[model samples]
Target: MRLLIPYINAMIKLRLETLRLSVSGRITGTVYINLSKVFFPEETWNDFPLTIFNWWSHSFLNGNEGDYRFMDGPFYFKIIKKNGLYFLEGFFDRKLIVSTELDIDEFQCSLIHNIEILLNTIKKNKWDIDANLDIELLNENLCKLKKNI
Candidate 1:
């Protein structure tokens, strides 16, 4: 039974990371962000969907004072899907902070697929990139993952 639990966990982990080769040529970044309001389809295990309301990027550059500084990225989004049609689900700070349903449009589906690839690449090793801390990105990803019905 203990071995089964470990196997189940490993399977779930793999499922969360595996890229859907069937849906290629789109998606990017460290996390999945679909513009649609629905993350999971009707046949999904959960109710809430996935989405990304906004995203911020921080990059290192020379500041006006002759020092390196970071700048925030843009924050814009669209509704990709209607409801109930996504694979991945998440929580904030390890708790069910917010949840939303997503609907993946053509563009969003492409983006989510690419993001899965990016996430897999990042998991190969660690880097100094603050890809997870940008407010826009956090807000967007959080909004997509945890929005109320």
Candidate 2:
């Protein structure tokens, strides 16, 4: 029994190490995915611009470590587009990362490719930027002040 326990622990460690290596190492950045702006003006339903119907950042990362499922986190947002493409910008982890204006009909495909590349690039490049996560985190409190009209 003792021998098996040690083996199990070793396997778990190895698996975790493998996952870490497979993903970009030390990848910490804010990722922004805009849903409607340039190409999807009519598609922009409700007041939320960046977010689709239920696809909040808190629920976006189904497989990522930051996936909060139902609990709303500070990182989730839906920006208002006044003129140009409503951008989704924030300091993720610590690095400044931005998503291309996502109005392409095939957004699902582009999103996967873009995020994969962005995370890898940030992980490899190790950019030094202001922490935007704090802003998102803080927004949670201020958002309550808005009138429910």
Candidate 3:
């Protein structure tokens, strides 16, 4: 059991990061104000269904900054300001997960960062939508965004 722990952890990390990239699609260049709202909303996980909402609500209620868990693995996040721009960064077990730069100013950055963090957490956990939820529209929107990118 002890020997399998490392392998299990690595597999989980790979799957989670792959899902994150799939959802976020490796943003490049500067994200303007208009696009920022679309890509990184006030609640990034709002588009997703109930599991994500549970995760977000738990995180929000706990107020656990810099340290969180997804799929039983530890993760961390931070909102960084550099050159008058904001960046939302994610890390898994001290390894870099993603560093997304936002064009928004410092004032509005935290809200976006909070949402991004939650969204990433949702992706990391591989939460699936329930059958009752209308996920087609969400999939369509994500497809459109991917095509635009």
TM-score of 2: 0.23
Question: Cα miss at 25, model 1 (Å)?
Answer: 26
Residue 116 CA displacement from its true place in model 1, Å: 1.5
Q: Candidate 2, after superposition: displacement of residue 27 in Å?
A: 2.5
Q: In candidate 2, what residue range of length 10 has the lowest lDDT sum?
A: 4-13
Q: Candidate 1 lDDT, tens digit per residue, 27-108? A: 2222323214322111122210111212211110111011111111221122222243322223332333223332323333
Per-residue lDDT for 118 in model 2?
Answer: 40
TM-score of 3: 0.27
* Number of the predicted model whose lDDT against the real structure is largest: 3
- lDDT (0 to 1) per candidate: 0.26, 0.27, 0.34
RMSD of each: 17.6, 20.5, 15.0
Clashing pairs in 2: 29-92, 30-92
Please provide the root mean square deviation of candidate 2 (C-alpha atoms, Å). Answer: 20.5
Task: Estimate TM-scores for all models.
Answer: 0.25, 0.23, 0.27
> Looking at model 3, which ten-residue stretch has the lowest summed lDDT?
3-12
- lDDT (0-100) at residue 25 of candidate 2? 23
Candidate achieving higher lDDT, 1 or 3: 3
Q: Could you tell me how far off, in angstroms, the CA of residue 6 lies in candidate 3 after the best superposition?
A: 32
| lDDT, ranked from best to worst | 3, 2, 1
